[model samples]
Target chain A: MHKKHNFGAGPCILPSSVMEQAAQAVINWGGMGLSILEVSHRSPEFEDVVLKTQLLVRELLSVPDHYSVLFLQGGASTQFAMVPMNFLSAGKKAAYLDTGYFAQKAIKEAKLFGEVELVASSKDKDYAYIPVGFNNDKHAAYLHCTSNNTIEGTEIFDFSTAGAPLICDMSSDIFSRKINITDFDLIYAGAQKNMGPAGMTLVIAKNEFLDQAKKEIPSMLDYRVFRDNMSMYNTPPVFSIYVAMLNLLWLKDQGGVSGIEQRNIEKAKLLYAEIDRNPLFYGTADVEHRSRMNVTFLAINKEVETGFLKFAADMGIVGIKGYRTVGGFRASLYNALPLSSVEVLVNAMASFEKIYSDKTVLELE
Target chain B: MHKKHNFGAGPCILPSSVMEQAAQAVINWGGMGLSILEVSHRSPEFEDVVLKTQLLVRELLSVPDHYSVLFLQGGASTQFAMVPMNFLSAGKKAAYLDTGYFAQKAIKEAKLFGEVELVASSKDKDYAYIPVGFNNDKHAAYLHCTSNNTIEGTEIFDFSTAGAPLICDMSSDIFSRKINITDFDLIYAGAQKNMGPAGMTLVIAKNEFLDQAKKEIPSMLDYRVFRDNMSMYNTPPVFSIYVAMLNLLWLKDQGGVSGIEQRNIEKAKLLYAEIDRNPLFYGTADVEHRSRMNVTFLAINKEVETGFLKFAADMGIVGIKGYRTVGGFRASLYNALPLSSVEVLVNAMASFEKIYSDKTVLELE
Candidate 1:
């Protein structure tokens, strides 16, 4: 098999062990003679799985006792509307931090419900850095922010919300680092990135936040409904949840979020250091606010960028092409991405730089 | 391995070959070292998968050219709200056929959008029969109905809709029978029972219906957004869609919808025959309206019902217990249930009835 180093932004790589476990469950779950996909979600087997998965999320994130972990569908995009649908009460405005692509999407959806206050924005610099030093309205219904911008490669590692309830969309960089779970009233992540396959969305919300949600919210979109039904308000994405459960088990085995954080740091550092040293490459996002999950850079020119893409592909490096809006290279070093893969990418960059160096110019031409 | 016969209501049984293919994709898809889970949704490989899956659905259902097939997340329950959210225009009420549990859920959500007229209902008879001979309001925006009630074990195999758009929720018996694609303006099904896993919902809507839908619908919940984006409005439930695609392939191999319909009829006939012959068993649904997918029945007595459950468990039957609201037994014979499994269930019923035949023996005990 021709193995490729996966660096896709989301719907990214997962641990082999987790994949194996998921595959096994697809055929015979715990030797029950029925595939996990075949079993009823309400059955005892799946009930245990759902509960155990919630517990793992709690243990890994050090989630407070009052918080509820729900495995939902529709990705983070659905949560954009659901957060406001549930929490943004009548006559109240929501405070939004316009970080990049996703935050803008959230703001657009929130506008359908109530007024939105743009507390801070990084669009002035093409979202090269996370916005800082903005005063938020304390009376706003909730403070919404994207924890990490996958497309722009900017992250908010340290940010303080005003008195309003903090609602974060951590889709792209969850479980790759440690964060105080109690700091936010609600934190949601699409499982495509550091969590699992693309299908399920993980929502960790405080009990009080859910209790205070509007009762008229659609049952499927209501956080309180999901929390009350244990994320089975309706037929959930069973296979997606099973794979997510396996991934969480793998994350726990990998020493939870704290243990994975150190490894992520090493991998990001290796790739960023090479980008800095290599003459052909330059970092796009501000170095201080650069995302550890997705490391974005640009080649000296479009021709060089195209050439480097071919070189990376030939080296079995996959999904490193930058997002369309950001035309460069994006090496997504998610939790499942090993340091060795980053080394291979770094080596590829070094080799390409050497071959295209100014000293060797015009030799072939 | 404990081999249990899965008769689950949903997240139900699937073909072994389909499960194997899905499991293999979890490891190496088309020998491309990356797991199907790892590939980006925008990647050419996944793009092909998504398009091919839509083609397969169209092919299997013989869906017309003017109808768009969408693989969406949030299940049919989400579609419950989305149906009215998009189709129910201002000042136009929707006509709902409240046949059973799921139908009521749909009505409840529809009420949130506009006035709903309950044209017909089976609630008076504990949803034992599909309501018939009722006049529908053709002037209403749309007529919404659940095609098959999974919990109630009743089906509308011969129902006529008003001149308005016919939106049917075919969650339980979709693809298990031959359905006339043009009869409904919109059809949605949760991909758990006869389709695949639970994460995805299959929506087949006439292109014109989508074009005329409310423009203000949320992107994720809007059928037009999904159609315009080819169901890639966001990161879709990837694994779920792939499995559904695989199941569609399997269905084609089993002779598409027609072949599966034949098998389904035979399985239901076999179980119902046993219920009729056995002294202990009596079907709960009206004889004329009994569902071919879900065959609900009850034992002669409460003690016998409890005893048979334990007996069925010892005989390796799983998920045969009726829905909580409707107590007894509900053998969900979905598309994947083999005639042999139904025969086994029939034999178990016969054996149980013989062992508990004497009515006077209970008093002696």
Candidate 2:
């Protein structure tokens, strides 16, 4: 069967070899004659998988030695609440930049713990662009931002590299690019995007950020519980973490983050250029703030949008439907999306333009 | 290669077919030519999986329509905090029955939200037995208990199910029994036990209980979010839930809860009977409060325990080691544990008995 070019926002595409190796471990892990799922997280073998996965993340992003990496559940969504619960103490307020649907969710969650001031917002323009030069409080504990707006295809071009300890929800574009880890106080991402599978949420936090937690919070939700135990607070998502470890190893083998980032830049450029050059389609995300990880565009002729969709569907471009909130097309270009897949999407776009342009001209005359 | 039994507490054993189906879906899901992991949770097909998984859960447990089934992450460990975060309001004391490690964790989390009263406890006896006569408080919001203690090898004979809106953490023995689902207001279990794999927690709650959630809780932790969205508020653990649904369907094919309950009872009886009949082994956990799912036993000859473990290991009886907190041998007979596996454990015990008896006589002289 031909592989489809998957553009899912999350619970997204993973390397084929990672899936195969993961499946093999499901039946019998290593030579232990037991499934990896059956092994104890406390066991040395399972511990190594967790350690190596964290190490790979550290190495990929060049994470500082003072920071800790954690594998959590509930994805980036869970962190929406946990961030406030841990840090939003003393009736103090936190600043958040509103970009897309997830930003709205984070804002809502933070409101429960303490005050959340919307520092900047692109809601007026339907989150079609990333808001910059945010109004933030100097007294605020931290400034939160989503590195990549998954729904809106907007990306932050420049951020406060050293201000109020930046906390980023990098769920969409963590290891896909080379990041200056020291710039952010804490960063979290679900493994489904650019990493490996669902079930594990990767959290990287500075040691000092751990001091923000109040004593009243639950231990499991506390960063200290995970940090102290070394992400072994509970039996982790073993199989997911193991596969993520394999994916990280795979990523490392492919020239680390720098190499992949360059490839991602080129892939997104190829696909976005096809949308820009074609009269049949127009890109949605602001050209200046376009995400390098996701290419979002709308069909130029609304009446023929269904026809374009059908054409793309026939060509095996799956999960290209933009979020309902921002209807059109969105091709997520995560780390696992190879250059070949991007080429395929570009070719599909060209083929659609050739088919639709002739029909549109006849109607206009 | 033979498949060995996996018994590492949570993230434990799973249905063999679930893994096979999950692996297949990674390549192509329902002819979509995309990995199941690559589909958006917002999509209709993924939503179908979510709804169907919930529907089947209701059917399997004979759960009433008033009850809502929620799939969340962080397992029972997170629920420990989430329950209190949601339901603990009005300064009313919630009854916490400290049965074992998980129960104590819940108690610790509850203290953060509101006043929690330790209504009953088994801690005095090192959590080896379920306590008796938990006073049902008319003023109490809920009475929480751990139905089966995975570590302590104890289970409540009858869940204090009828009074004070009973809530139970059935993590270790959820599907291993047939119970009146209506008797409890809430029942939760992590999928690792007998359901499927780890990284997913099954929460079944009365709709009214969800309505009682305090507005102070975070939106992501709100039961209302899951209740309204049918557990698809965010991208779910696609692979984990798919595996869980597959296992649920497989259980239905195996004659549902009633069928599995009978098998669990038989499996537990087989192991416990061998322990009682043989003088070399002594059972942990009180006889009256003995768990039907996990049977923990210690060697009567103190020096021969290691030898017994080695003998059992050599004979291919996996996961026989008891929890380190309560040291001994624990044979967990969860829903996925085949009766044949119990037979293997018993056979290993029978052989070990002969060897220990001969060695003890020589040492006594």
**Candidate 1 deviation (Cα RMSD):** 1.7
Model 2 lDDT tens row, A263-353: 9999988988888898878998889999998788888666657787788788877778877767888888888888898888788878877
C-alpha local distance difference test of each model: 0.89, 0.82
Candidate 1 Cα outliers beyond 4 Å, as residue runs: A362-365, B1-3, B358-365
lDDT of 1 by residue, A1-365 (tens): 86789998879999999888888988898888889889888888888889988998899999989999999999999988888888888999999999999999999999988899999999999999998888877799999999999999999988665578899999998898999887899999999998888999999999988898887777888888888899889987777777888888888888889899999999998999999998899999999999999999999998789998998999999999998988999999999988899999999999988877754576655
- The stretch of ten residues in a row with the least summed lDDT in candidate 1 chain A is A356-365
Model 2 chain A: lowest-lDDT 10 consecutive positions: A156-165
lDDT of 2 by residue, B37-115 (tens): 6677777888888888998899999999899999988888888888887777776888899988989988988888888
